[model samples]
Target: MDMSERELHETFLPPFKATVDEGVASFMTAFNDLNGVPCTGNQYLFKEILRDRWGFGGMVVTDYTAIMEMVAHGFAKDLKHAAELAIDAGIDMDMISEAFVTHLKELVEEGDVSEEQIDVAVSRILEMKFLLGLFDDPFRYFDAERQQEVVMNPEHLKTAREAAQRSIVLLKNEGNVLPLDKNTSKRVALIGPFVKERESLNGEWAIKGDRNKSVTLLEGLEEKYDGSRVEFTYAQGTTLPLIDRSTQKVSVTEVPDRRGFAEAVNVARNSDVIMVAMGENYHWSGEAASRTDITLPGNQRELLKELKKTGKPIVLVLFNGRPLDLSWEEENVDAIVEAWYPGMMSGHAVADILSGDYNPSAKLVMTFPRNVGQIPIFYNMKNTGRPFDAEHPADYRSSYIDSPNTPLFPFGYGLSYTTFEYANAKISSDKFQSGSSLTASVEVTNTGDLDGEEVVQLYLRDRVGSVVRPVKELKGFEKIHLKAGETKTVEFSIDEEMLKMYNIDMEWVAEPGEFDLWIATSSADESNHLEFSLVE
Candidate 1:
């Protein structure tokens, strides 16, 4: 993708800058080209910014066959040219690409590449190897006995369960339908593709995990409720279309076969509540899994629509790697849970949340769009010249005629069993000089019946800037727990450092301007904001 220099530095480079600041020892080059130059052969990125400006003394490795891919990017003529370009661009190691090993020596001999460049690359790799003590004990990390002993130990499993519990985001809970009543709801019907599936729970990146050991949603529910008190039934209402990477073929159409629809509907009819486990199969997401449509794949949506006809409360649990088009699910489903590939303890963790054993405290880091049309939707976006006004609906505004400009669920949004009320938001001062700091605080009180955790978010916006700024930027956030009826004060120290950005002249500085601040629940929250100014 062609990107402006300003966009590159402001939008893309900040995270890399943070890694450099944290003294990261290794870096991987991307496969894509930036501004016509392949990342593996991008001299400006490697030499100018990474090495000279940031002083990153790390070994740079090419992503698998990325050096050779530079030829496909048209940045290099051949394998030899690619190797020469990579080494000159400060690349140290080649991952699964024989381009360097096959052509580097010949290129160096022909004077197309220098001995100094090769020496520098070798030294960086050697430095990392030495740091890792690989030279001291070559097979130190390959102990099969120790691996088996620690792989899925009790403590590790407990930690995994806790982590999975915290990672579950409660996207919707209409009529307080969630925290499913195990005691009251006698018959629980687990329906959809993921009801008993275990392999996909480990997700795409888990190469060595034993799928048999992983817990399914069916298994978790059964373990959670007593057989005498609560009876759990399951139905595979739909099957996810099989994605064959080798053949690049899908087993089913977008609206898959409806053979299991009848059985699934029957099961739901006999149940008190229907827990539909659905989402992209593990292979449908993660690396190399790009899609133009990101709705519920195959027959899942059809199955859900059928289940809705049963007049039972449906709790939709989503297992996805990315944000999805959840507009239909949000409006129709009684409750929605984002259970993103919760690993081996997926079932147990989900059961914990559903049974109210654990009040889910996880907030969404990514925004969920209403549809795939809003592919690049985000919380922190610049307000266009003609921003959409909900009060004054105009055709000329920057919005779709088909859909609203807002997301299905905004960033930093999640539900708790309990509710928290924000009050008494105040700042230390209305104005502050550069280099000085100010304090912003707010009081959060648990206003619901159950004790739960809430993520108090702090967002800021520059009223005016040298360049346009995001309407709202998340500056700070704190996840705090409060007992029912308890109150706590959350304070955030704001300084010039938090306000720094690349100005019009491309210099990193905090421009003197009026700023708006909010201490609220989510990025979409615009209630009771305070205004402040930075003096020159």
Candidate 2:
């Protein structure tokens, strides 16, 4: 209505679009703030923004306990007001938000809301329940026989192992120390408090995940190791870091008190090659788990440093949710594997990778910093009016003085035993009309002795926008495989939507101008840049 309040209008709409493209038609709203406002009864999420703009006619379900939390959110006058606002806003059903079922009918009778709206919402909720086949037998999912039959099926275990292997980012390897020979490791030492613990393997949000059923790294090694030839030794070393909270009363388990840190250091001295399984316990990540100090907790850091002085080759295996401070390990450790809580099959996966049965191809999704002060470091950065160039640091550029503005281990950083090279990238056109498609091709060659896979990432920068754009945007990506000494030509189609930049009015438009296409190995720029145009 007014230009002065134009920015406020955009706020009335859903700031982030729900992932409707994922083929999930049912209601799946997060319980918390979506763009700084509660999402449970958010009108922007259901009626005006979702259905009107995104065409999402799917069920709008309440977040867990959100229908009730509205009293705390202060949006509703009472339980009845909460139900009416949510239902009138197009919320069809409630998931653990009991206010809807309790007051929906009463509101309809009083004419505060209508039965037609209630029925409409209830119908969509039932439709999803029908799709899930829950109506046939609501208790079928809880059947113990069915749970036993499907739980950790052989195929699921295999998948868990594969996912584990894929998630293990080899952070550091010096002098070709990884992929150890199974025949050579006659006496192996798995010295860590986590090696036998079951609770740490199953990460947070893991509903119904059996901790007792999990095979720890020590257990996995003992089960696989040839008893006649191979010997296994495990020390109850320091406890790893658990989640840190500034407000909550913290219970720090005395890692050094559990076992003498000196004893563990001595154990490392005698082992053939030390495999130090370290990092945070499961409570450190996921919901409500933010961190101030992202480093090896307890006495683990001191233990590692002391163990390094023993002149024994060390392999570091880290289990964490987000990236951590690993500058010393990256520089010192002979080998490092970033296994983000590999689930029930974590132990077997580590053994497989160590025994050279599986070749890892996991890449870093977030940045690892030198310290906590350099946190929130990710792949994407905004181009300031003055950007930094190392060659010309004195040009009043965009950078930090004390520490480099870059991350220690960048986004898309990963390792395999093999190596790959990219060449011969070509784009089909310099210009594209609205709703048209553009093709970009490239040749990827695996130069190492082992076969592996690489994820080809495509990024775009919308220059001359009515609004500001990130330095680079992850428009498209594809994973490809290559054989040793083999080269394959890969192509990705660039849709017109890739060129659409959000205007000051929040309208997506492909303005007529030159657009730059960046074909890279990761989210960050890897090799070369290609230019193209988007015509009217």
Candidate 3:
């Protein structure tokens, strides 16, 4: 949330620069202080960087109550002082704070803030309104007729279902227990608190969504099969507690009732295949919702243990916003589906993936640690001076004594219904000039029986630079689909810009050195690699 000037410019600022390049209409200042200064009142960030360097002509808005919080942050004398600092620093609008409305005029009159600065801020806000056509017709986006026609229409629902299906990430599939035979006459048991939760399906951000219209996993399963052929039973194995975000506390009344645990076990025993929909409810993982423990909550894991004793195939379907500590589930569960709050068509998408109507293709964008102890672990992390040496364990190099120093799932990690094999990578040239481009290519073959899409990732490491660099960084990626036994070569073009880094002098330049490039499935899977050199 916060970083030094160099780290901010080198890492966090790139995406913001890209957004400005695309002509985004507005930008919001962060709530946290960047370095030492509060982001809402940072002159360096607003004036020197965003406005002057990036040439962002858009309006800069403060996050909710950020201006007022500046006083709480001890940076401002009071609400009036906060408003003056924010305006002079380039914030155009105060969101929910009303600091500007209460204090800006007085500040200008007192000669503490220039009237010209106020005019500039007001001009940006008016320009955005003009661009949005709100000046001509304030009700342009508030049409009831348009809302009735477009909202939750058939086309929109189809797109939502398709998008939900694509968003799913299949975490584990032991012996290919998933894609169960829909035609077979089998008892399919769907168990958990999340199975029929329509209101929690959209998660926290969907404040205006119609919860009644959203389909649940139970509803989707029923629609997928004929009632006569397939038997579906649902049991609320555990309940989730309602959390108070501000206080980080739960009510005694909201504590889960484990009375349904025995019923869930009984249902699992009678079923041929079990799908346990387990995870944090809508309240457990979003904004302001921090957890000291990242494991399955309440009696959810105990419920799974009871279901597993039935000696039937069990698939765990998770629905949480953040990465969970699935070390136990990873060992016991036959298969796992990460159906992260799949919105309006949550049920349909889960049914599709479970029934094999759609092959799972989405990759995990963030790294999943083995436990909370590895909280800050990431793929692009730099190798420290005494990095963990597996071969020489007694050397006392950097490592965890209790657990292995590796993530449960590395960044860019995902699985498809079909398997893909990566061959040795090759490059167009051994050496390229600073201004020239080099091509890296690798052959990927669909080795499994099913056709599927794979996201081929390209990563590289500068062997040596003026300053230490990350072990590897993702440069480019492409998603491609192939039939079974088909082989296709994926290529990525690399130039000096792609390899450039902020050196000791903080100048973005590609130093003359060898680069080790890998073209493979994920950051951890670096078996297929090639080397190249950059010339002056």
Candidates' TM-scores? 0.97, 0.89, 0.97
Per-residue lDDT tens digits for candidate 1, residues 267-307, read 99999888999988888888888888888888688888889
lDDT of candidate model 2 versus the reference:
0.74
| lDDT score for residue 492 of model 1 | 96
RMSD of 2: 3.7
Query: Residue by residue across 61-175, what tens digits does model 2's lDDT show?
Result: 6667777777787777788887877776787777786887799778878888977887787788788788878999888778999888888799888898888877878877776
Clashing pairs in 1: none
RMSD of each: 1.5, 3.7, 1.4
Worst 10 residues of 2 by lDDT: 1-10
Which residue segments of model 2 deviate by more than 4 Å? 1-19, 34-36, 142-144, 185-188, 223-232, 241-248, 252-259, 432-435
lDDT of 2 at 536: 77
The CA lDDT of each predicted structure is: 0.90, 0.74, 0.89
lDDT of each residue in 1-536, candidate 3, tens digit only: 65655677767889989889988889999988877789999999899999999898989999989999999999999999999889989999999999999988888889999989988999999999999999999999999999999998999999999999999999899988888767778888889988887888898888899889899888898888755477888888888767765566765657787799899989998899898998887877677888878888777888888888999999999988889889989999899999999999999999999888899999999999899999988898888888987777766688998888989988998888889998858899989998999899999999999988999999999989888888999999999999999999999999999988888888878899999999979899879889999999
Candidate 2 backbone overlaps, count: 1
Q: Candidate 1 or 2, higher TM-score?
A: 1
